[model samples]
Target: MCDVGETTWLDATAQAELVRRGEVSPAELAEQAIARIETVNPKLDAVIRTRFDEARLEAAGDLPDGPFRGVPILLKDLGCTVAGETTAFGIGPLRDVAFPFTSYLAEHFRAAGFVPLGRTNVPELGTTVTTEPKSFPPARNPWNPDHSTGGSSGGSAAAVAAGLVPVAHANDGGGSIRIPASECGLVGLKPTRGRVSQGPLIGEAWAGSTIDGAVTRTVRDAAGILDVIGKPMPGDPYYAPPLPRPLVQEVGADPGRLRIGWLDRPGLEGYLDDPECRAAVAGAARLLESLGHHVEESAPAAMYDQEIIGHFNTIIAADTEATMRAFELLIGRPIGEDEIEPRNVAYRRAGKDLGAVAYLQSRSWLEAWARRMADWWTGHDLLLTPTVGAPPPELGWFTAAGPEEEGVRIISFIPYTAQFNMTGQPAISLPLHWTPGGLPVGVQLVAAYGREDLLVRVASQLEQAAPWSDRHPPIHA
Candidate 1:
């Protein structure tokens, strides 16, 4: 077999090319991936379960001639369920809840010939942006073990960053995909709301704030994977506007000159991204300018209002409560307080206290704000910001003594990402800068709703201008 260490660093597309050329068999690829996971997953804690034998079995059997035939990937231990596989959602109460059928995304992955060897770790119910689940040890940043791999896609990000796999499933609901991508120095794309189906189970998540995606080391890998899975499944509540052409075609395509806005602050009072993080965005602005894009200083004024922030959080909390209740009904018993994390218990209480009318009002407010936010894009094609408020934090940095504290800490570290999630727009995080301390700092690029084609074009341009794929973490395979 080819050197597992060297092959592991290749993107999924490159690996698939090798399989197509007969340079390696799918079984060999799976074995290499499994070996790498066994080697590094102990230190990273990125994977929470295993199906190595199943992966080998599939690799040896008849496989579809899909683009990604034989690529081994990990499904984040969130909502991307596989039938009969445990989907804990990173909570104590749901640990034993194996899904009865595969989710739409899982089926798409299988059809694309991806062998899911296991599920990665996640925070409880994906409520937080860090992947510290009470059900298992937190997934560590492969760059630095003591630091966080941003959640709830932390495990997926960690695995990709550490070279355990070239790509893994991740979903964004309030920055779950981008935060970890930024923290782990991988390419993270949060597709426009409804870009990918979340169906056969639920039409929408958090009122359409949640969207499925993947973490990858190369821009083309991100685009290629999106091409495979972004199709609108039957019964989807809605779908994003169709792409004019294949996403892969946009990867190296010229974006032409574009107007871009750079917003260093998240518009919160007394809040600023770390100096390094701010510099990262500034550097990206300079890069875009160098590439002929018109970069200016601007942001949507609607993002600063206190009332809007309150309404946003209200919707999220209400969704959490509703999800818990749904699961309670499924199992025929209410989840006990001791069965959940303390902070989530408090979130449930807050959600329960909000009247249904208030919840609907909150959602209505968000939709109105989304319209206003979209209007801001009239003068700009993209907005640039720091992926997170700060670099990946040291473990325990965001620990809270109470739910109130948890709420405060949540927004403090992750201020820029959720706003786009609320707007159902497309945004991406690219690893363009690294701190002097050697941690990765990502710069975010956001485009109008249903403008992933534009995002992909620009992201591919940036990826070429400042390549980060070869910059492996200290703990990589």
Candidate 2:
């Protein structure tokens, strides 16, 4: 019998290789994953729902010989609905309602032979940047249980970081995937908008500001899973330009000497980067230059436009209102303040009151600015920055004690990541540094739209230059 504890740290690809060699059976893998979740979840609260019995049954049965066959995976609770499973989306009303059909994303995961072990936690409606959902226990960071696992993919990142699974589903709209990956010390890639479908539910999320991907311990696992899940199903509003070749192949491929730009400044005028966070990006830039890449201190002036934050916030609020209204129709009742978080109620109200013309103006403003932002990439293939404006915050830092407090905390922390979401570019967060206190600090790399291949090649190169897979948090399975 394979030692379950020994297998915890292998990337999904390596685990799959073991299964291929018959060194371990899929059932054995599933059992080990379940064991890890049972042991670690009590402390981390990363996985909020479980399908252990179903996972065991699926693993014991004939499964697809897919690249990651029978690997146990957790789906973030907000998106990617699995049939017969309750997709709570971190809201109170939907917790008990099982989706009638599995979403296309979940179906793709199943087709790739990833057994669904459970759904992870998220902030209510994924509206905030920390995972202290009123609907479930907060997803604690494995690095330090007292610090937050960034949201709304916080649970997925925590599970992956804690070794509950090698890789887990995560999506990003306003940096959900990258934020948690930064805090939890994992590789998170938010593929170009439309690189993966959001179908059998909606055409796109947050008006194409969001995309789906995963958080993993290795760059290879991140790239490999993208190859598995990054397909456009029929009826997608638009698809990202297809990759020249498989993303997995891009890993370990020669990226050659490339021009890279670096930004250590926060986009928000009054905001500042912590010394440790600033050093992480500077250090990554120096490393890039050492590796023969041209490095420069530059960023788009458009990114600093004071109005950009308001525009993105308005759009997000509008989308939230639309989602909530749709939910009201489904349940045939209005959601009360007691039924939802207070901050969201305010957002919904603001969105409901937004004039349609003003909403269109915000969208138009973003589109025009995106053109200006693209010009910066002309002489550079990549832009590097601290993944977040600061390191992971202690738990309750973004508490919903009051609406003003929550908004300020969010603005103070996530100033660096929302720009790419508005531009529909591919961005990834790599755990490249750790603070003196032992918390992880991530360095981000952003590439032009439809240029995930470049991001993958360069990220894998960096991964080899500074390996992080061996680094584990104190609270591992």
Candidate 3:
């Protein structure tokens, strides 16, 4: 039998291979992961809930014969709901509420043979970039427990980086996946909008800016998992352009000489000009140039439009209000202000006060802004930038002053990632640089809509050129 300690560090793809080779049984894998979570989760508070008994039973029973059979995975508390499990979405009132049916994405994860051990933590309703919710213990960064783990996928990223699990389910609306990946030192891919369905319950989230993806330690794991879940489901409102082949096939494939634009400065005014972040992008540009790609300093003009912040907030306010209503329907009562976070309470009020015309105006304005942003891709195969405007901040950084101050902090931290969510483009965050303080600073590579193939190819090249798989956080198993 393989050492469980060594197995804990293996990526999801490798763990599945071990199961296939008969070197490890599914039950053994489950037990190892459960032990790691039990040992490590107290320090990080990453796993908010556990289903260890159910996981063990599933691992011992007949399992699906899929690409990732026997691999244990964590689901984010916000979405990707499984029947009979609580998806509290980091809200205090809804903490015990369980959904009756599984979401299509969760079904895909199970069909692809990932056993769900538990759900990770998230900010209330995933409203903010950092994952410090009042409802649960904040997810501490594995690299430095004092710093924040970016969210609402922060819990999953922390768990993965800490080696509690190889990979975990993460969805992005505005940098949730990539932000956490950047902070926790993992690979986070935000697939093109509609690439993964939110069906049978949700058609769109945050005005179609949200999409499901995962954070992993390897590019191939990201590609392989995307292949398993990035399929069109019935009743999906829309679908991304189809892939020519499975994404996993693109790993290590040559992404012929391509023109890439890089940005080191903040995309929006009032955002940070952090030295570490700028250095991360500059370093990635130099690396890309060395790898035979044409790299130049450039970015979309639309990124500077200050209107984006307000419009994005408008959509979020509306969605936050709607989400609260949805929860009320589920729990059969009106949620009081005290039960919700202050920021979300303000959002709900703003959404309730917003007239239909004003809401439509914000949506229409963003639609036009997306078109302007997409034009940059006409001349460039990729855009490279810092995943977050700064490295991970200390815990409570976002909430120290209150929601109003938190808004400014959020914009400063995440100016680069939310735009792609609006434009429906596929973007990835790679842990290409580490700060002098030993914090991870991720550089993002964005492809045109539905061009994950290109992103995967170049990411694999970068991964091979600068391998990060061996780099583990201080809080590792």
Compared with the true structure, the alpha-carbon lDDT of candidate 1 equals 0.89
* Every candidate's CA RMSD: 1.2, 1.1, 0.8
Which regions of candidate 3 deviate over 4 angstroms?
A: none
Question: Backbone clash tally for model 1?
Answer: 1
* Position 90, candidate 2: lDDT: 93
The residue-by-residue lDDT of candidate 3 on 1-477, one tens digit each, is: 777777987999999999999999889999999999999999999999999999999999999999999999999998898888899999998889888889999989999999999999899999898888988889999999999999889999999999999999999999999999999999999999999999879999988999999999999999999999998988899999999999999999999999999888875468888899989988888899999999998889888797888898999999889889989999999999998889999999999998889899999999999999999999999999999888899999998968789888888888789999999999999999999989999999999999999999999999999999899889888
Candidate number of the best lDDT: 3
The residue-by-residue lDDT of candidate 1 on 1-477, one tens digit each, is 678866988999999999899988999999999999999999999999899988999999998889999989999888888888888888777777777878889889999989889989999999888888777898999899999999989999999999999999999989999999999999999999898999889899888999999999999999999999998988988889999998999989999999999888667654545899889988999999999999999988886667766887788788889999988986789999888887778778889999989999999988998898889999989999999999998887666446667667887887789989989999999999999989998989999988999999999999999988779889988
lDDT of 3 at 163: 94
lDDT of 2 at 378: 90
Candidate 1, RMSD to the unseen true structure: 1.2
TM-score of each: 0.98, 0.98, 0.99
Locate the minimum summed-lDDT window of 10 residues in model 3.
Answer: 264-273
Cα TM-score of candidate 3: 0.99
Among the numbered candidates, top TM-score falls to 3
* Residue 379 alpha-carbon offset, candidate 2, angstroms: 1.4
